[model samples]
Target: MEIRNPIPPFSLETALEKVQLAEDAWNSQDPIRVSLAYTIDTEWRNRSEFINGRENVVKFLSSKWQRELNYKLKKELWAFTGNRIAVRFEYEFHDIQGQWFRAYGNENWEFDDNGLMRRRFACINDLAIKEQERHIV
Candidate 1:
């Protein structure tokens, strides 16, 4: 079944702006700032687990940083239609044992009328290897 987006075509530019704001928030690594992009009751499915609420989002992100040291992420806009957007990104981080990992993923987002994300779904695959194995510059 084809899912119809509630937002009109003209509003896609604003959606793109929101996507940029979220990207900036993630790059900052401040969970508080990133959490603002989502609604207080936002829902997310990251891989297999389900996450709900802004506070839980922040907690999950904080825990992620504790494990993924030196975490850096870069997101690229792939496609968008009104309040929905698709992004492709790569993130690099090292664990406590100093083993580095580069994860590649794509996320699909849905936002409310106020440009706050109401739902998000992400699919990620990781290659856990030494730092020297990376080829992308």
Candidate 2:
């Protein structure tokens, strides 16, 4: 049982802590590092793609970071109760050609008793933006 700490049945403070931790991990852009926060059999729905298991999480993140260069992410806790949390987030990134984009979205996460996220569903939209228009720098 690998516990990630701040185990569920979250309070406002712990939920906020969890959100911040996720934001920091994502900003690092290290797929393997980020995948550790989820369960071995975690499931996800990001945008239109459906992914299952930690292996796929790593693969998905690797592909994402490769195309989304210099990515920076910010996540805010929206609501929480028991083993679930909801968040609204925004992230900024650029492509290989230096075209910048900002993505805005919401995510619902369900955690296992051990504190690893067992499920995640995200709704995100990306908009083309000039570098100067970036909110996350």
Candidate 3:
């Protein structure tokens, strides 16, 4: 696995960098690449589903992109303390049938010493919108 840089105990700049790195990684929609940012035994609660370990994380992300076609995401750093960070994000995607939707969410992340995420909890809700309502493509 490629070791991620900017290991935690983050300064304002590093925290912002972390958030942007996460946004960039997710935007790539590469499940394995994204999963490597987390610990091998990482734990996650994404909405109602509970995911444990890096392998499951890959599976979850793969399923997500399958349903959320052409996904585009933006993430903002909400706060950071110690090795933990909170983020607010919005993502635009269409279903396989091409019904547009925007999802707004918050994620709380805890990272290990190596900067690999150890835990992540997210709460998200989606709103249906017309194509014209979409601000991000």
Candidate 4:
């Protein structure tokens, strides 16, 4: 059996669209919707650990929300190619104890012809401090 590409076309516009969709999904705080953006067998290297599959994606996201309070994220498209995109983003959230922190990260995403993410590698660094320490909103 042959698989068909679900995406309309590969262009800079489509790349931007995918980024916007991801941003909206994250903003909604819906783990399932976010997971759907990736392939069923997606591979991920988030910070240190390696995770695969949609089920693991959902679980990881759920755990993330459980630990990160008042989570809000913003992602920007940095660059793109035929089936790859680079994104830079920052997120601010508080811990279980209400100790606020900001995390900055960059991600390289590879998509299949159907535009579903096949691989994602992200590197993030977090700085935890008091709320008063924040300068950027």
Candidate 5:
């Protein structure tokens, strides 16, 4: 029964805070740390993959970071309502061979009363970029 603080019925300030916190967590590239922000049975649609439960989330993120090296992410608050939020985000990452990419996406999230995200839907597109073209700053 962990309450993730800044729970539900989000105001503009709270919504922004939530989005910033999420961005920080993802940028950390720690699957276990990020998974804790979601509920035990959290559901997610990341790119074309559909994942359910926190365990799956951790596995998915672990696999992702392993493949996508030097990951950096930025998330912006798009909209919000009671227990729900929408975000637009961009992230930069490279592969083991150092092929760089920038990914742009949107996510819709629904949180439980405890403020742990129970559902997340994301749509993303990745663009190949030269290593010099990338500015993850």
Candidate 6:
């Protein structure tokens, strides 16, 4: 649980590790586990909603995955500096009606010295697609 610390000044390998770690955590779709990677006082702007603190993060993600059934995600590191990292990501999921979609997004993350994300801003767009169009396996 205490992984990916020593916040920032990342090498390419560490940056990739960070991104993959995030991707894997999210794909698990466990809100509580994902919230642990963030600071207790984390601030987040997820799409149109404003979220503050780990409790809100857990609430938001639980609601998200509940609606985004069979969610799968992939993320790539776009850039990194001192304690900030930028990422681009894609995810596929379906609604309760069984309509599939793919979502594209970018996130800017700032980490605390302990490697917990202190701030996150994300912009995302969803595109409806057929099941055959899904690329994530």
On residues 1-49, what C-alpha lDDT tens digit does candidate 4 reach at each position?
2232335345778777878888878877788988988888999999998
Candidate lDDT values, in order: 0.78, 0.95, 0.93, 0.83, 0.94, 0.91
Q: How do the residues 1-137 of candidate 2 rate in per-residue lDDT, one tens digit apiece?
A: 69997999999999999999999999999999999999999999999999999999999999999999999999999999999999999999999999999999999999999899999999999999999999987
Q: Which ten residues in a row have the lowest lDDT in candidate 5?
A: 128-137
Q: Once superposed on the true structure, which residue ranges of model 6 sit more than 4 Å away at CA?
A: 1-6
Tens digits of lDDT, candidate 1, 1-137:
22222333425565556556676788778888788778889999987879999999999888888898878787877888766788898888889999999999999998776667789999999898778876443
lDDT for model 1, please.
0.78
For each predicted model, how many residue pairs clash, with residues at least 3 apart or on different chains? 0, 0, 0, 0, 0, 0
Give one digit per residue, the lDDT tens place, for model 6 in 5-109: 545777788778888889989999999989999998899999999999999999999999999999999999999988889999999999999999999999999
Q: Please write out the lDDT profile of model 3 over residues 4-32, one tens digit for every residue.
A: 76788988998999999999999999999
After TM-score superposition, what is the CA distance of residue 104 in candidate 1 from its true location, in Å? 0.7
lDDT of 3: 0.93
lDDT of 5 by residue, 25-134 (tens): 99999999999999999999998899999999999999999999999998989999999999999999999998999999999999999899999999999999998898
Ranking by TM-score: 2, 5, 3, 6, 4, 1
Q: How does candidate 2 fare on TM-score?
A: 0.98
Which scores better on lDDT, 1 or 2?
2
Q: Once model 6 is optimally superposed onto the true structure by TM-score, how far is the C-alpha of residue 21 displaced, in angstroms? A: 0.6
Task: Name the candidate, 5 or 6, with the larger TM-score value.
Answer: 5
> Which predicted model would earn the best TM-score?
2
